[model samples]
Target: MQCSQDIAAPSEVGAYLLEHLPQATLITLDTTGHCPHLSAPLETLAAMETFLAKE
Candidate 1:
């Protein structure tokens, strides 16, 4: 799965992942830069737990 910051991209990156990596998951958070784990730890952990629980 891919975790992307809402502010970091050409947008097509997420689209490409979804298209080319159909088995993968993509998560976008309303944050800046590339350190969502530090900036949004709770949200990031929650997302990770949710994704992992699915498996």
Candidate 2:
């Protein structure tokens, strides 16, 4: 998971991971900052739940 406007890691990092890792799941929260879980708790949790449900 990552914040769309994260400066520390950036959304490109997530995209790269998703492209490289076959099983990688990229969840981009439409928010700012590095910590998506803290900055976008509900969105993060929802994404997590949706991802976990697929598994």
Best by lDDT: 2
User: Ten-residue segment with the worst summed lDDT in candidate 2?
Assistant: 22-31
lDDT of 2 by residue, 1-55 (tens): 8888999997778889999999887877899998878888899999999998999
Best by TM-score: 2
lDDT of 1: 0.70
Candidate 1: clashing pairs of residues? none
lDDT of 2 at 11: 70
TM per prediction: 0.72, 0.87
Q: Taking the tens digit of each residue's C-alpha lDDT, what string does model 1 give over 1-55? A: 2345445564578778778985977877665556678888888888889989999
